[model samples]
Target: MNYKPTLIFGRISIAISLLLIVSLLFIDCNSDRLADIKETEEILRKADASIQNSITQKNIDSLMSFYAEDACLLPTAEPKVEGKAAIKREWQHIFEIPDFNNKSTLTKIEISKDGSMAYTMGTYLATMQGEDGSPVEEPGKWVTVWEKQSDGHWLIVVDTYNTDIPPPDHK
Candidate 1:
């Protein structure tokens, strides 16, 4: 047996094995990251569904439960509403409207790599009694920022929405 040939083959085999190990490690890291993203997405989806349910049921407490203590709400043509108490008050006012109905469909949700923060953009359709007690429908878009708390629950930290169509006076 030629010693040179044997040594060269042994070195090549070691290099190939190292490369495979590194590749496997990289793939495992990526797999974990993907799983985290999927989990975050699912959490956001469930939260969105719960929010819609609360709105449909006109449950102000349930709706406020989805928000963080320091959350902010930026409503259309209105000043920013901040904190849980303020947000609760805002929802209270809306829920008091006669025959108020609202629904939201999430279009996109993006989460950070660390799984600590996320943002969701969506569309909303709402119906409520107009001044004459007639049903009025308003279609709009919204964006919400979510943050993960120490309890491992995600809550909305910032929310904003605006109507797709301008008010009649604008036309």
Candidate 2:
């Protein structure tokens, strides 16, 4: 007599369980990716070094080579610079600044335990000539998220940074 309620409940539970299992099947467990953490980390570091060298030399083409096509730059006090083309334009403008110079030191490179993602944190010293022809140096911190592509290469996905000094509007 009471079997109807029990049967319905059992069916509902089974449906939910099946749904969860199917979802897991589609999820990226990353069990097969980045199995070699140390090697991957070293590769990432070398790629980052290439990026730094490009920046130091103000080489736009080389600098842009490390970014994903959909990469984004979260600049301070400005709208998000999105996509490869826009990001390239932004970097060009930055490189054109008077006496522009920058050096970034990566403090840490953390890879997810599951090897699904990696990111870097660092400090940068950016110097340029102010409107009054005076040297202005801004020491700042930055973080960059990286993603692995199907081609076995890592590329920058997101980059964000801000200076310690006050904003121009507040100054």
Candidate 3:
């Protein structure tokens, strides 16, 4: 007759063990999701800064560092430039534009919940140094798409832009 107490205790232990296993599984799943979210945000930040830095410095070579080998750029006014070489030429032409001396800023960087992709869309204000070296500011907007590489690096998959104000020649 003391067997009743032993049987009840064994059942309670088994129930508690099952609950612990489910709780652990849930926790592990949540942690993995959180890590993915963090990684996605980090990639977004890297892409945002890389593009702004490239434009501000007008460094075509440095700018290409962020691009994937097969990346492409679709300019607002011109045909799409596919591949790193074409993109480099595009940047070179941009740097040579009249009063091309300028700076830009980026904001509103966002990433998908799954963290596989991201984009940075923002306004840019650039100032051209006059022949007198005085600053002239021009503002525009840009959007860039980013992909996370298998090596854990983020690269620009697509780059595109549009100016808030048309080029002075157009006006």
Task: Point to the candidate with the largest lDDT.
Answer: 1
TM-score-sorted candidate list, best first: 1, 2, 3
User: TM-score for all predictions?
Assistant: 0.91, 0.76, 0.71
Q: In model 2, how large is the Cα lDDT of residue 155?
A: 89
Between candidates 1 and 2, name the one with more favorable lDDT.
1
- Give the per-residue lDDT of model 2 (tens digit) for 18-55: 99998886564443444578777898889878988999
TM-score of 3: 0.71
Worst 10 residues of 1 by lDDT: 162-171
| Candidate 3 local lDDT, 134-160, one digit each (tens) | 776667888889887898888889888
Compute the lDDT of residue 161 as modeled in candidate 1: 94
Task: Give the Cα lDDT of each candidate.
Answer: 0.93, 0.89, 0.80
**Against the true structure, candidate 1 has what lDDT?**
0.93
